[model samples]
Target: MVVEYEDSLEESSYSAAAHEPQDTARLAINASRQDDLADIIFLANNRRVTDMVASMPHPFTLEDAKALVKRSEAGHMGNTLFAIRMKNTGRFIGAIGYAPSMEDGGACHLGYWIGEPFWGQGYATEAAHAMVDFAFSDGGISTLTASCHVNNPASRRVLEKCGFQFREQSKMRMSGNSGLVNVDRFSLTRSTWKALKAWGQAA
Candidate 1:
């Protein structure tokens, strides 16, 4: 089914974070809507959660969610964005999306975040796998990149499972924490993903 959401976001500014899940939590990713504001605020209100993402505003508020939904509903030209939800219950877990990165020579960057309560269930991996598969299969994206705080091993594992290769380590000012932090970057090329698929190294 074609995904649905009401918000539009800047590809350059859609935000970033680490999201993962266990092998059994099959998540259904879809577009973000205004109605999700309450859910978003409730789950994203934690300081610990915000500290790890690069773009999420700490004290994530109703206004923020409103603006996100309003702008996102308006539209972003080349970005494919969405919210992550439980497949069966349609419960909101977090968010995931891709935006074209001009500095990366037009490669799309993959980003996602799952609620703390939902972590370790492979939901992040499931969402990433779904997004990566769609981006290549239907969106025509050739390359995808991602990053996580150097301290976040589970987040890195999510990318590894999806076939992203670790590229480098760097430091950046994290928006959520308002501080500079170390991070590890990774990337996956369309060719590599296809090869992995053929060899069954990735799903």
Candidate 2:
């Protein structure tokens, strides 16, 4: 299930530029959306999509969404995992953002998910590009890491578009489960970010 891209980006080459995250930039990232639990639950209950998620459990409810909002808000020191919303309709589509590990002070992990109804419309790529730009900007990032199940081609594509380079492949225990699953890790550094910005401008 571990799919990798032939291309690679150096962490030292991406430029760190200030990028104002816009809610209307294809997709929006929101946090502290405990009030939107009902909608979140509705989206979470979509069996068509959750079947693909590595560790997401079934029968999502309003309470589950509320707990997610609460935990995501209070868990990370930098406040990761924002709600993903549509710009035009102003409807919550899913969630996105970085999650930091206490074990790795300088590294942060990026993750996201979208409702099935919103799939295959370029929202993931758009939001991921924005998130990467925001993270690599000066005063924004030290290092960023992301991973996906080997079978998650769409997720891998999102990482590729964000200029991440494959670091390694390993197994990790899934949430709400006891077994291990294969995953591909990708990483980016600030200097590479600067270069990436320059390349983007030149292109």
Candidate 3:
């Protein structure tokens, strides 16, 4: 899923380090950089990648990548943007973060996308866990909302694994596809996230 938001907040940067017990042990959620533009364009230009995202334009150009980086630097309505990277190699594999859900009162909207080459790996889930943890613990978000194209089961699984509950299905215009598409919405509250964390720790 992709998210684009407006309004402004002072820029800030932080990192959320995650240690996974499986193959994704090296994942790190860090701020996007100017250096990431080339990599972003390369990975995001694929039709397979854009079709599943809502706002990302296909043929993802340098200008598009630059605009994204600028937004990350500027911060969007209390939004936090992170680059999903390999801690060991410092390679940008994907992007994930959240923004205030203006329509949902105090809720924040979570969104993410992984490169085509990295599909089927657990990187998305691992990064999502880190983002969710950061959102609740450090980002001061009381609730998180996310949505994905109805056909994208991979994304649905990521949200499910992260404790988001199905909320609804709605239609939205996808810029990448240049048409309207059906999307499934999901939400996770702070209390639920805390319980899940406590359960995991207890286990």
Candidate 4:
């Protein structure tokens, strides 16, 4: 899918962070919507549940949001974040994207969060599946990895539902904020994806 957005930064960099899986059929990752900051801030600030997302907290201020927009616009952080919008409402319901890994070639970490009001509606699953498909198909990525805080079962379920397998336990030393948190690593491979599709068809 050729997902185009007006907020795309002209400059960006990417690298592999973890074990690179060989796969095809990756999603077309893109940038966040520039003009929709007000709505993003409103949803993010008003929704306490959104605090589950690392880096964003309840009462997210405009200052913090401005920084987010700036970082997204700069596009040099190796993180390709995109806003999720409803085709009908054109409202920004959430965000999802891949953070290029610093450790391995062709490997990227997936991250996403949805607004509180939109939970349990399958949007997260659909968006995540689209991203996985892009990573494996379009990005030519062999392996895609994601980490969720040990306490975040919903996030873990999202990853598993999309075919990622539990890999290992690890800790994330997040920058400039929360010190450290236990995280669970999950991964998916091209062969596994193929098998998943085959299995789906069989079922």
Cα displacement (angstroms), candidate 3, residue 104, comes to: 4.3
| RMSD of model 3 against the true structure | 7.4
Model 3 CA lDDT for position 132: 73
The best-first sequence of candidates by lDDT reads: 3, 1, 2, 4
**Residue lDDT tens for model 4, 25-124:** 3222245556768877877775444435655655677876676666555553335566677755567777777776653344778878787888877677
TM-score of each: 0.81, 0.78, 0.84, 0.71
- Tens digits of per-residue lDDT, candidate 2, 50-81, equal 55454466666676787778865664333456
Which runs in model 4 stand beyond 4 Å of their true positions?
1-31, 46-51, 55-59, 67-79, 103-106, 174-177
lDDT of 1 at 82: 73
Model 2 TM-score (2 dp): 0.78
- Displacement of residue 184 (Cα, Å) in model 4 is 1.4
Best TM-score among the predictions, by candidate number: 3
**Candidate 2 least-lDDT 10 residues:** 1-10
Give the better candidate number (1 or 4) by TM-score.
Answer: 1
lDDT of each: 0.71, 0.67, 0.76, 0.63
Off by over 4 Å in 1: 1-25, 71-77, 102-105, 201-203
Q: For model 3, how many clashes?
A: 0
In terms of lDDT, the poorest run of 10 residues in model 4 is 5-14
TM-score of candidate 3 relative to the true fold: 0.84
Clashes of each: 12, 20, 0, 23
